[model samples]
Target: MRLIKVDHIINFKLLGHGDDPLDTKKCHIDLNALRAREDAAIRRAEIEAERIGAGVTTEAQSIFDALSKTLPVRWESTVIVVLNEVRVSSPYKPENVVGGAGAANERVKKVLELERKRMQHGRQ
Candidate 1:
């Protein structure tokens, strides 16, 4: 008995003894095309992931906007920055507020807490 091993499965008729020779060209798999398709799919997935990661959530954006009204605020990735000193990470809880010291940081933390609660209540 003859045996053949293949990494990829392709549908083709097996040639029995005394049968006409099989066409090698028709049975070949285009590795380059397969690789290109795989690469394209990976690239598309990466692009989508990057797009999603680049934007902050509506809640985070609203908080940022509110803070911007009375304080120096900017976004560092998904984290919110205030006065270039304090960093508020996602979930935007008061405990997540960090960095800096003094009255200004405390004020920022208070504002964040209030905004977070207000937004939370507004949602319900």
Candidate 2:
């Protein structure tokens, strides 16, 4: 039902009196086939994207798990691990680590200061 004009030329003609009905039917069939193919392609791309996302999440979790193991259980109460866990839930991904690393380091520095304050209060 949509009109597609190309360079001042109408590629398709409306079926009317004395016009060929078969040609119009053929165009409709071709358009439906093209749409079906496009939809299938879009679905495939979405599935692939989801698969990649799951792989990335799994890798990130592994890295965090290794980091956790490197430190003692008592250290889990530390600010660094808490902040890193927060970033794990963040929209930022490992691929963007180069740009995000600086900001993350800054946050760690701030968290370190807070930890120091908490320790001082605990001793009081």
C-alpha lDDT of all candidate models, in order:
0.79, 0.44
> Runs in model 1 with CA error above 4 Å?
1-53
lDDT of 1 by residue, 1-124 (tens): 8576785557779687673458675587889999999999999998555433247788777788788889977677888888889988988877888898778778888998899788879989
lDDT of 2 by residue, 61-91 (tens): 4343443343321122211143333332322
Error (Å) of candidate 2 at residue 71 is 32
Which residue pairs clash within candidate 2? Answer: none
Candidate 1 TM-score over all chains jointly: 0.53
Per-prediction count of colliding residue pairs?
0, 0
